[model samples]
Target: MKPPSSQGLRLTCLLLALASLCLPIPLWKDRDSLMQEEKAQETGGNLVLSRQEQQLNTKLVSLKKMEIATAMTTGQFPPSMHFFRAKRLIDQSKVFNIIKLMPKGAVLHLHDYAMLSVGWLVYNATYLPDCYICFTHTGTVRFRFSKPHPPHPVPAQCSQWVLLESYRKQLHNVSEFDRSLVRNLTLVTDAPEQAYPSQTFIWKRFEEVFLIASGLICYAPVFKAYFYQGLLEFYEDNVQYVEIRAILPTVYELDGTQHNKSWSVAIYQEVTRQFVKEHPDFLGAKIIFTAHRMLNVSQIKEAIVTAMALRAQFPDTLAGFDLVGDEDEGHSLWDLKDALTIPYSLGVNLPYFFHAGETGSLLQGLLLVLHGHFHLGAVLTSHPLQQQNFSAIILHFKVKQCLSQPQVLTADTHQSN
Candidate 1:
């Protein structure tokens, strides 16, 4: 959507002012005096406010007024609307109360690579590709880049180029991509109105980088470094804990021996424990062993077994199981229910946090199945709840719900997703 113009913002502010009359009389009875005192504190000796600050203050007043009015009329706003509206109420009249009202306990299903800010990856890690490789001239999320067989000598431009990391620390701003590598590689715009984009478009580029990063993480030490970096990034966002969904991609070891998924899990668990000990603010972290949705029945069974064993070996850290990837073009989770039952039989309370309703049909089918077939202990769906039985945290693009807040690991589960 296009950014609101100045005129639009002013009109919205006016609407908000009229809406403020709907607030309970008690809330506004002392509001004028409170606002006067605040204005005095902000302006010091002068009553005149700067143009920009005046505009902002006016906007906040109008927004809170509208919120109170809506709440009075509707009884309560939808939780999502509450969050969005509260974010706009910058004056802190009832900010604390609003936060308390929202249930943002745990975010369960975030992809690791996508969770970190792009500025960090590019600037902090120096993640720029030395060689460009495009999969096609059109849209694609995966591509092959040249291996730095002969690492390029440090470029002289490095000394002059503005570093993304330094800019993050100093200015805390990210540059929006003006052009994508392809018409749809880093974006897929179908209409002219959608042309101008923000960090959201950068997210598409970030996904492409994950293919390279996963390969890099297969190395024991590289995995350690990446995990450490990811942890720090999460903490910066006030997340106290995380449950990373890691799948060690299939790759050959330096010695020509194939390092299978099980081996990768073992190494990942060990590293996770050591990392947790190193960061005190972090209460804990865990793994929800994931199987690719595209994998066949046999592979799915083996993946579940791998997870079961991991749970036995690392009970506290291996919390559950998940089927990851796009569900649109694959077999439904119900299609493999028989094999899924195997994990439970083997003493792995590997609760299924399956990615069910990620697609339109899949979402509907899974909702019906969860409602009828199994008394789903908890369910995560992109759709909002119709009853009080479920609680959820909606991510930037996905939503997660479970029977009860999955044992809070101390970190925001939303951060994990």
Candidate 2:
């Protein structure tokens, strides 16, 4: 082959440069532009809105704009603030009144012990005839319903369990005592962020409060009424249906007679049924039996067995089972895989509603859903990592035939902060 001349090489290079200029260049979007595009795509798909729907959406947008404007102008806390701070401002601004009137489809993630007001638990539940309380050395308060008497002599456990009635009598004003009790039972404070420095600190207090309430709520007589009152509270907030997560610990009667797990479940069913019957407008309530994540494998297995039995007895009202505790400190869902799979292996229909990734690890949550095969339900915290991983998991699993059935995926926004 003959080599090209210098002029021929120059001509070739010039032609290549001209060809490059004619070729189309690919365009790349920045992060902000991509996000905006995604947002538009999401909103643009539902362009054909009904007249009523359009009016409602317009009203909502206008209200939100007004709220933001007011917050900015007055230098008040805005709706965009942390939930606790925003809630405080909302309460003071009376904005919560509007929210209260709005119809909530279903409240699905409330812890049963924390649903009712602390004031009601202290003033009403603890004010019962035979209620007693003991303050532990660790600053945790425990309540019990026993026969009306003086403090019990249990020096080994603690000094004694004092009758709430006696304390009420000793106090100059019972209302003040009730208020103090409310403080012990709730996380409500002027500065919650300061009081609870971290999630660990707050969750410790949260668990302690539950323990305090459990002693009173686990009493057989109070169990039924307390559940009913909780339903009523949700009803007042325009929540028609609820699924409450409860430990379902063995309950005790006022006479100190202990009731088995089955009895406690029966009580739950009865109370829920009666409440629904009376308040016909309310859809109904279901119990999601929860086991502590801190429990050993054997304990978890036992809890699963009991939950399965309860489901058999009350299939209609027993929604499902869940593992509840601070996800960061407790055992992961994988640790109790055998126990979790028992219901499936036994041909029972109990579904899993495991709390995963509440601590901030999306990878941990993804493993819980994928490896555990929790196709029925999964509760995840709304951290950015979790959200991204969740979206990936959905896309990853959506095509699998085994996961074809509709699954419940709930995000716990409460822990996002």
Candidate 3:
């Protein structure tokens, strides 16, 4: 098919303009009002707005009244009108005042490290030792020092990890594969199955980045800055509560002052308490302890034991457990089911959020226990060839079992209704 001629495009634009004017007086009036405002600004005179401007302003007020009516009646604005009014409100610089009137909720899937703003990282480094950073031969920018100085300099570099001045400016250079890396490592993707063909390959790369960043983030004083950064990001997003999945305990000091789960929990709690005190809107935080599948039975047990202990100390703050690391090369939660059972029994009250049925598993007796939970019947469907329903079924079974009877929030008449 040939492209439309220039005359055809001109006619289409005119028709669309006429159609818009005929449909809504507010649309045409709002545009006319904007033109008048531009003219007034250019002329440097305080001339009264035209009838169109008055009509547009009146329409805006009417829309605001309708917003309140709809929200009161249905608990939310109509989807179409909501976006239109919201855009106008924000453009008028009243978004914050408007949002402050609404009740906000919790933010999920916030990674603690990336939340740190560059401003905080640089500003705080001036007062802390080991905040000095340099580019290593490997080209990865990391914090380490012979003396205390400014935070990692703007546009500084390390092996392959360079801090760009602007994320948007550098975004164009990031390829689709790199974008996938960012999403997988950062927990930005919702449905990993549709996002990736093999969790085994994706997670292998994920663990490698964690290993690399661990050493880079462990420098003294970075933890404090990191915590604050995460808090600030949550604040900026209008989140009242945050349940960040932090892997802080995985990082260690240069002299081997290995930060354990306990230390990480202490740091997290301290920061959370201080932040909530300063910012009353800031509610609370919880932890999701993640263990590497590459760990041996003993190591896995120790990790779970640490998680259990933390849960005991901070019952409300510590949420649950997760398994991370290379899925293909290492033993999965299934392989360590017997070893994990002891901890599960001991921490029976603690919740479990296992990552199950992701990439490359044997089908032979797959019916056997998956991470100590048996798979029941699957919801079979048509068109088996094109769909990954077989894989999704197992994941569904894992989620079902994980959220089953034991922690089903049983109602108790023992307490007042």
Candidate 4:
């Protein structure tokens, strides 16, 4: 059988070549569009939808349109309006109610420090023993959990620290006092336009609120409770998993025993382990160890190295690294390329989840995409915030994605609706 005649072999080969020519070649011209369709499927486009699911999706589309029409006519729940301002209006939307009822998989982009409510902080942390409170030169509030004696230096912003427990008892209406504290620590207001006149002002106050809240959270006992409570809140929201971005605050004891960065990372692992053991349905959480974007390249590089070391020690909990801050005010991705490229140069597979293109300029966002091409990592772009070129970023950089704009980092309600 193997010893067929050369003539017969030639005839068979010729026949096969002719069949191949007629079979079909890929249409290279449609490659771009075809790839895009596949991309859509990868990003929740649901190409293989069942008939029932498609019908439900169509109904959802109609509901969206109906809601949009009502919103346009009533000027209610405007997308441009602040979320806090329009929260009541959102409550009235049937679509929003339906969405709220749906179980969420994960909160991809959360700042662990700001995950819980100001009310939660008031009741949990403020009620703890040895807690002290004071007011700044301006009307902003301050908190600390150290002894009320002269040893631990008081912040100049807080003139005199009074025991929070005693202060609460002095008030006729403790609830009202706690409510005032909540207002002091949050951006919630009857009029956001008057309170937060400019973007700069809002961010400034946003930073201030974190500083105010940090005092209670930095306390050792409170730190542990805060982390557990944060996980619990996400669990209640039907979020089985979370990937948090945090600056890893210095946790201190009432006796002034402060822990290091490594200790903080360990506690995160410990708390998460305890949480998962109790509630197995909640998959778990990861921390994208973060450095402030405003830090120098050298500082950030140091941070990256520290993150690499920490990730080595706590591989499961330390998810990766990221640069976090208000994009408009902090160092741009281009400016930090030296530091950002370190992971690539060192041949480390530590994935970056940098909060890029979070600024309000599309041009700036696109420019950030150019610098980010040097590093193989994801850019957490704030959508339509000068970040309209996400497709361009993904296509060019071959990036992964998640919506992690660090909203929970502060009360940045002005931009949301």
**lDDT (Cα atoms) of all candidates against the true structure:** 0.50, 0.70, 0.53, 0.73
| Estimated TM-score for each candidate | 0.50, 0.75, 0.48, 0.75
- Which scores better on lDDT, 3 or 4? 4
TM-score of 2: 0.75
Q: Against the hidden true structure, what lDDT does model 1 obtain?
A: 0.50
Ranking by TM-score: 2, 4, 1, 3
Candidate 1's residue-wise lDDT over 324-368, tens digit each? 654555567767666666754554355555545444334644564
Report residue 248 deviation for candidate 1 (angstroms). Answer: 2.9
| Candidate 3 accuracy as lDDT | 0.53
Candidate 4 residues 242-281, lDDT tens each?
8888898788888788898899889989999999999998
> Which ranges in model 2 have alpha carbons more than 4 Å from their true place?
1-56, 79-84, 92-95, 137-140, 148-159, 360-417
Q: Top model by TM-score, which number?
A: 2
- Which runs in model 3 stand beyond 4 Å of their true positions? 1-104, 117-129, 132-138, 145-209, 250-259, 326-330, 355-417
* Positional deviation of residue 230's Cα in model 1 after best superposition, in angstroms: 1.8
Q: Superpose all Cα atoms of candidate 1 onto the true structure and report the RMSD in Å to 1 decimal.
A: 17.4
